[model samples]
Target: MTEEREPGFQEPIEYEEECENCEVRVAAICQSCGMPMNSAADYGGGNEDNNCCVHCCCEDGSLKSYEEVHQSMISLFMKTRGLDKERAEQAARDYMATMPAWIGR
Candidate 1:
C-alpha cells in the first residue's frame, strides 16, 4: 500500500537574520513576557526603542514619528512600570496611530 502526502503541509523558511517587519531588534522585545515579536522594523530607522524603526513606513502615507515624541507618555502606562494593562494598551494604540511612512527616510 502506498501513503499519500498532505496537500498543504509546507516546511517553514528559516532566516539567518531577524524579521524586518515588526520587532527587528532583539533587545527591545521582552523574553519572559512571552509575547509575539513586536513589529519594530516596519518603522524603518533603527532605534533603541521597541526595535521597530524610528522611520516607520506605515501603509498610510504620513510622515510623522511619535516614537520619541510620545516615549515618556507611553512609559508611564507601561505594564512593566506598575501601570494597568488598560493604560499600556491605550498608549500602544496612540503610538502606533502616530506612526509615519518612512519613505526613504
Candidate 2:
C-alpha cells in the first residue's frame, strides 16, 4: 500500500500574549497596523497579518495557505506603507514564508 503524505506546514505564531487572567490575544504589531487580533479569523483568514491579527487568519496555522497569504496582505502593504506595488508584495510574501511572528514570553 502507498504511504499517506503529510500536509504542508504553516509557521506558528511566535508572539501570542494573554492577560494574567489567561485570555488569549495576538499581539497586533504589523509595523503597519497596531491593532492586533485576539483570534485567528481577524485578518480575513490568511497571511495578511502574519503575526499581527486582523491582518490575516490561518485556517489552522497551516503553511499550505500561502496563496491566501499573498492575496490578503499584498494590497495593504503597498497602499498603507507607500511601498512599490511589486516590491511591497514581494517583501510581504517573503516575510510570510520565512519569518514567523514574534511570540510573547
Give lDDT tens digits, candidate 1, residues 1-105. 876534432222222236778665443321112122335443324322332333332234232354543454456557456766667767655544433221122
How do the residues 1-103 of candidate 2 rate in per-residue lDDT, one tens digit apiece? 9755333323343456566787866554542233444454654344544644444443553333445656657786888888887888887766555434311
Which portions of model 2 miss their true places by more than 4 Å?
1-35, 39-55, 58-64, 101-105
Clashes of 2: 14
Q: Pick the candidate with the highest lDDT.
A: 2
Q: CA lDDT, every prediction? A: 0.38, 0.51
Error of 2 at 57 (Å): 3.8
Model 1, total clashes: 9
